[model samples]
Target chain A: MEAFHRIWKKWRHLLIYGFILGLLIISLRLLRWKYVIADQSLEIYIGIVALFFMGLGVWVAMQWFSPQSKTAEETESIPGQEPFSIDEKALERLQLTEREQEVLGLIVKGYSNLEIAQALHLSVSTIKTHVSNLYSKLEVKRRGQAIGKARKLRIVE
Target chain B: MEAFHRIWKKWRHLLIYGFILGLLIISLRLLRWKYVIADQSLEIYIGIVALFFMGLGVWVAMQWFSPQSKTAEETESIPGQEPFSIDEKALERLQLTEREQEVLGLIVKGYSNLEIAQALHLSVSTIKTHVSNLYSKLEVKRRGQAIGKARKLRIVE
Candidate 1:
């Protein structure tokens, strides 16, 4: 299924266009069957065909590319092989700025403020501001609390 | 597009069925034009219709649910939720002293030397010595690095 899905995802555009062209040929055959309609009616017939195909398109999209499909893939994933990923939800909920997140990550690893500033090539005072903001956003009073909360919440990895 | 998608996702089944039924009615009308075919051929025609619609479905799914269509919410989903466990092997390899192990765990939980000293009923100077020893054993120069290394090595939960 995974291999089939990969090929499907890669060649989907070509496949779709080819199918549409095939349908067009079929429609032309229908036109030549001595069932000649007026020009205006021909346009309407084409519209109906397009709409039907469009409905099919929407159904196909939902089946394989939706969030539900992603969830299914995740469940089928092998255990203990997936790489570490940060808790995006917690990060968003805390509304940490990119710089603050960087600072927080460093802090979690045990870097002092001066070391964090040096590593980031920022001033010590600037790192200090970011650290304070991190504390406020994380709603923690001390480094230990922040570190514990960050790990417990899986905010950093 | 997001709003339309929300509505479409909610009512897609109804929309798809209604569309298929509408096409069926149109096909019936064509059949009434005295274009009767053998039963086997009729089955083939239905198969063709089904295949065409399947193509259309695939096309539609790609357009609306593909990676390019991602919203902020989609990107913020929490991934695998694995629990923390101490790596006994790594702990053994590091050969941290009992006091150092306690200090390392506290440090991971965000404890400062003064706090760790207070908690362990040791002098601040003694806590600092234990911290230095932990840093050397962990091969880290800073608290941040130690914390990061400790977690990565799973030496502390």
Candidate 2:
């Protein structure tokens, strides 16, 4: 029953069209038997009706499938405003301790050793030690190098 | 003349369809007059022709206007592989000199002043002066801050 429903959903339009065409043929044959269309102009009448239905099909297809709607969807985005999410894989691969990660985040935010110490409630020496450990783990020499590496690796936002 | 060309370009398909439709009607009418189709089955024949043309229209519209092709185009791009272009507007806003820009680019690449001097074939003291100028102009006291600002502002590729 489920498979039958799926097939019916896919081809319902064709089935509906075929049923309507059959009904029209029956009604028209009855009309022809009662009274023929005058001047043998039945072909012209059929040609006009066929062309109208063809145009209707084209219009319906355009409504359902036009690529312009996709282009409109794509043009709505403004670049660089996307929310920042840290790269967890890189952080894990670097094997930075929790304290070290905090220090690195502050360093990327342009905080000084004393500032970081105050913010984290640690001594200046402790902050300095964390900074050095970050540099070693990230394989960089200076603070600028550490910041560059962190941003490039997406280890910090 | 240009306006006429533009209109023609936009409606050429409709005009060609109209011409073909006219020819088909003429030939169909001629066939009806020349050879009478028997048994009053003309309506069924016309219904089949109409449905065939309508299906043709739908197929043509799907081929030319389907959004799936647009989606395929969008999925072809791999994120983060786009070529980086330096922001000239931010560079001009910062009023950085050519030499300062060069030094900043090197600094962002994790270069020490001494390494930058060697790369630029300049003395260490000159590189130090350029670095200091970059720090002051960029309004950042530390090298890390300068690197961060340069990247955030897209002043360096």
Candidate 3:
């Protein structure tokens, strides 16, 4: 039972994907039989199969390219807390100052430093300093790289 | 020539998508012929028909989904630039202190306050302060809402 639980937890995503793919294949086969085996049913069957496969292909592609989950609902609920041990190490690598990290968040949104400073009510120089610090800690030289790193780390989005 | 350029630019993504979907349908038809079709010549004919319809389906879907030019690459290049523009007032709704923004990023990654402090090399109190500020700026009482607001503003992810 314990082993089953662990496998279920780890492979749920794969199981869901497999289930969807199985349904698609079965649907395709049904359409094939309905059309190829019957004369009057041919055109409608072909149309249905084409539509189903095309829709399935596009849906699969969308899932493939969907944004990584960063919703608060996904983040805040601790599933036994131990799941975060690996993430802790990634955070350690950032080495940001508290304020700098805050600025980095805004910077990732493609905010100009001036806009950030105004939003934060900090001196523009202070905002710039935090941004430079963020760049260093993220090991990225550009705002885009920092944002990419943050996303990869799941620190944002 | 100018008209051709205009049309090409407008329909480039649709054309690429159509080409890809066409290729997929062709491959699927080929697979079907190899496995299911008893007559080789008939199978080849069916494959060609499948490929044609697949191409047509993709063209139609492209016309459906390609009205917005917000490609994935473009979205990644500039983080907050969504295809649809929101109201200007909605844009101005939430503003975080630079430091609060950074903490929010780490928090979204399921970081504890102590972990966030250590990562940012700040005292726990300072981290808490930033967190509180983030909550206030986002007008949410919980960490999850802060993350949600950050996402909505495209501030973090």
Candidate 4:
């Protein structure tokens, strides 16, 4: 063990450097391959990649803001202000089952998954699955966004 | 000229190979430099970049589908069915001026920069600037995406 420790101490830095060098070489190879497959010219590859990302980012931005505007139109979002219109269309689009809807309501009411399970006389795992399904339907990750989008879509109220 | 051509033909492939090798070496060195500058260790960097792209692709897919779901609710997509809701909000957020809007319309209709300039009775450089500005606002690079996104956002319609 002492000898092993000694070897490790002596070669630790070299090991790290070697690993880093290997990674750089591999990454450079990938870059070079991409550069070649993209017409074997640096300028062309760069121009392509740059434009590709620009188009992609713009599309993403448009996707993000279009929905926001559709939902927020004529409904100025003051702090704690409720959305005036309940988007029944959006709710129908989400396709949440009745059980998932129950779990979502309790979730927005600040109940834990276990608490929701007990309240609904379901297993904790079942509640978790329901919550997850609801989140998937709403395209949200957290309780807050789930609740917010649910309200916005009129899935909750 | 004959002698020069004779020697050039003899050494042409060698010269090309040498140039390509030099570019690869330079590219590799630059890659090494970037990894160092980013304060990234190799494994962590590779892992992160891989996962980031995977996550980004999944999110993009979700976004692409979510809007489809919202728009296609109860009305399945038929062939050549026009998007019912024109996303005017996306255009409003882009902050395009009147002239730029006109230039964009021409661009969508397959007018070249020169054509747009002549049609608008403006200089080609002015048209170029307007096109560039429209691209900047739309966050796109290619004319196809610019036009497609414009139509999607209902900026043209």
**DockQ for candidate 4:** 0.02
* Candidate 1: C-alpha lDDT: 0.66
Residue A152 shift from truth in candidate 1, angstroms: 1.9
Candidates ranked, most accurate by lDDT first: 2, 1, 4, 3
Label model 4 with its docking quality class: incorrect
List model 2 lDDT by residue over B42-94, tens digit each: 66666666676677577556544433333322342434544567888989989
Candidate 2 chain A has its poorest 10 consecutive residues by lDDT at: A67-76
Q: What are the per-residue Cα lDDT tens digits for candidate 2 across A51-86? A: 766775675566454322233322223233334666
| Tens digits of per-residue lDDT for model 1, B16-118 | 7677657756874675353674454533554455456657657545643432233232222234445466667668877899999999889888887888889
lDDT score at residue B63, model 3, on the 0-100 scale: 43
What's the alpha carbon RMSD for model 1? Answer: 21.1
Which candidate has the top score in TM-score?
A: 2
* Deviation (Å) of B87 in candidate 2: 2.3
* CA error at residue B125 for candidate 2, angstroms: 0.6
Candidates in descending DockQ order: 2, 1, 3, 4
Which 10 consecutive residues of model 3 chain B have the lowest summed lDDT? B65-74
Q: Ranking by TM-score, best first?
A: 2, 1, 3, 4
lDDT of 4 at A101: 75
Q: Estimate, for each residue in A1-157, the C-alpha lDDT of model 1 and write its tens digit.
A: 9998988866675577678768866865665453665454533554455566657667545533432223322233334565667788878998999999888877775667765665565678999899898999888878767888997888886
The segments of candidate 4 whose C-alpha lies over 4 angstroms from its true place after superposition are A1-87, B1-157
